[model samples]
Target: MTPSPILDLAGLTLEVNHLGRGVRFYSQVLGLELRRHDEAAGVAEFTVNPHQTLTLWQPITRQANDERLAPLRPRGASHLHYAWQIDPAQLEPSKALLDAHGLEWQEINLGTDDRPDPTLYFFDPFGHGLELRGVNRDDARQPHFPPTPVQRPAHALPVMGLREVALAFGDYAAMKERLPRAYGFAYAKEQEDRDFAQFTLGPQAEPDGNGTPRRWLYAWDPQVGLADMLGGDHALVRFYADVDAVAGQVDAAGLLSVRDEQGLAVRDPEGHVFEFVPA
Candidate 1:
């Protein structure tokens, strides 16, 4: 059977070591609002956009044997890194907030091929690397590239949209094949030898209605070192959408959960780590 078309890029979920601590850090530093929490489920969710949510699941005692909660001794897995975009005007205020909270951050000027391109880097309380990009008004207001149809929701508000995601795989080809099989991602394009590929997912209808599909880019760079750089395997990006739907796909893919509670850090048949989230 054909897979259901992806509604849009959803948000990502993480399994944090301490749910309360993570919630405090993200809310204060990122200005996120807590949308939902279930102590019984050991889950807490934060909203970055209307449809996007960042979920934090605490380790359940019953599932302690899962590798996601394995003791960090020798060769333990690392936390995931995330990138967020913010308006240029909010950069200083946001940075100030972090400083007042005694949070250490690294200001980075990313040199891009385009004009007005710079990004700042910082770590969360848990030492997860994060990038804050200043959106170029010209670029943000400019028409979308490839000019695909877009349908605006009724109640529009500021939210973080998913841009792209990077995947690291020991075997690239196998991971590529499983994506289309599990998710409704169509083969869009591929870069030779660079081990990079792009996939498109969306509703089959036009932009005016509720059936618009989303786009995703999957990248694999074996040469890139995560340990010496950001201290993670790869990054998973999700756009604005429902959290449950995104999680559904992750479950369908049968990828192994990287975390003990909420997040899955499953490697596909090709040995690529796929980070699934709500868009």
Candidate 2:
């Protein structure tokens, strides 16, 4: 049980083709508070929680080709599969938020009586497959960090924060090896000789447990049987860690990664990008 330098699931950057429509859906529909926006860069930041952020970036071809951004080329993919954390009490109400806005959604149970993984699934205006993963807690426990009060719009879903980011790629084999060897992620769960895997960087996998907060990165191939992938699969997942350490491992593992004025970044075999910055 050694300590993990990968501090937290820092943020997620999504490919928001239209900045205004994407921002409106997340703000008015999901209730994420707007934190920062650089119109010139076509980027908008929303406060998901004290430790996590959800960013919407409209790819600026000219800006990305600029001398400064070209090296990193920071961008996100469309139709990425990701999840948001919410309490069980707020689960049913979340469906209402989707229906009230004329958005179609589905609810599913991935667990049994002993461990019920209740989830609400839906899509944003831009078609990113979003899931409201429930935090099923039977007893009260101390949280890893103090809760921050964020003022959200009335139409917002009762989302706690970014819970899980699931990426589907063809090169699951390479990513399965790359995630742990380079980033210190340990296996949480995996199926029999399967293409899907779960890796946990923090103590517990959710707010239900006591230690540090948990952030999830799920890697799976298309054959994993997703109802709908929304015609694309990939993500830009960020983490706060020792950049030197991440860079060191990237070299040791012989991973093709980018290091610039920002920090260390890498695109995986299936196009999902991982960015490592200073803690």
User: Model 1 Cα displacement at 60 (Å)?
Assistant: 1.3
**lDDT of candidate 2 over 21-109, digit per residue (tens):** 88888888888878977778788988887777888878786676124434544457677778776676777887888899998888777
> Which candidate ranks first by lDDT, i.e. highest?
2
For residues 126-181, write the lDDT of model 1, one tens digit per residue.
65556665554443222122222122222221224433344455666765776665
lDDT of 1: 0.49
Cα error, residue 107 of model 2, in Å, equals 0.7
lDDT over C-alpha atoms for residue 81 of model 2: 78
lDDT of 1 at 222: 47
Q: Candidate 1 at 43: error in angstroms? A: 0.8
> How high a TM-score does candidate 2 get?
0.83
